[model samples]
Target: MPLPDPWNRDSLVWRIPLAGGAAESDDNPGVDPPEAWVRALAAVALDLRCLRYGREVNVGRLVWDLAVDSEYFVSIGWQGARGVGGFSRGEGLTVDASFGEAAVWVADTVQSELAGYDFVQWPSRGRHLLLPRLLATNPAWVDPHGGRR
Candidate 1:
């Protein structure tokens, strides 16, 4: 039988192979990138001051449901390698985050950090995507194409 639907108000569903790899394979049954991704995400959660873990959740299960304030609940998971996560605020808001690559970091808000860059809607989700700059104003990201601003 097909696997049961895993999406709900409390869970995030992920696709596989990240860019192109599997969590498991028939010949090599032990390769699991999702597990590693989960570990990285959990470490990020621990370092984030904006998020607080509920009594039921600890470091071991940070990949599972997490309480985000009184009205919001968040969950993260992966099917193969494509990681998925989100932030939900009661019935009013639900932001789905998708990563083309699994190298992701979670923060309370990126508004301050991405200020002044042109942003676009990220797919159908309510979230915004920061546009890449031809000439990065920050000294650390100088563009080689001679478009410095």
Candidate 2:
């Protein structure tokens, strides 16, 4: 069978950005979602808390990027940290390294978060977030919610 979109240069397994977010259709603006290993963002699904300050960054645009490679995975948790007010700016990066990942050196927290952290280049409408790092998290730690941990 064919592999996935984020295959490493080393040619090992498969990886990709854990794409997830709100599923709003104008009726319910916000709702509490199950807390799980949601890639980079701290909050759960449909969690409007994360997109708090996104307006300041992109106003009303929804932009995203995801990258993956052998033995490592990257994610950009940009919802403006408004995703969770406890979330802060200028912290540089935040990652659950137990999963073998690292937060990139962010230039603009808002822009960086939306662009996936590695941010090699901008995606035109949005900033170029980056997820540039070789992961070291234990394989067993994956999907910690599941028996995978």
Candidate with best TM-score: 2
Per-residue lDDT of 143 in model 2: 25
Q: Alpha carbon lDDT of residue 113, candidate 2?
A: 38
Model 1 ranges with Cα > 4 A deviation:
1-28, 34-39, 48-75, 78-149
Please report, in order, the local distance difference test score of every candidate based on alpha carbons.
Answer: 0.28, 0.28
Deviation in angstroms for 38 in model 2?
2.6
| Cα lDDT tens digits for candidate 1, 33-113 | 244344434434443332222222222222232222222323333221122222322222223322211113222122122
Per-residue alpha-carbon lDDT of candidate 2 for residues 1-149, written as tens digits (9 for 90 to 100)? 43333323432221112244443222223532212223333221122223232233322233222223233333333223323221223231222243222222222343343444333232232332222333343211122132221
User: Model 1: which ten-residue window has the lowest total lDDT?
Assistant: 134-143
RMSD of each: 14.7, 14.9
The residue-level lDDT of candidate 1 at 131 comes to 25
> What's the true lDDT of residue 121 in model 1?
22
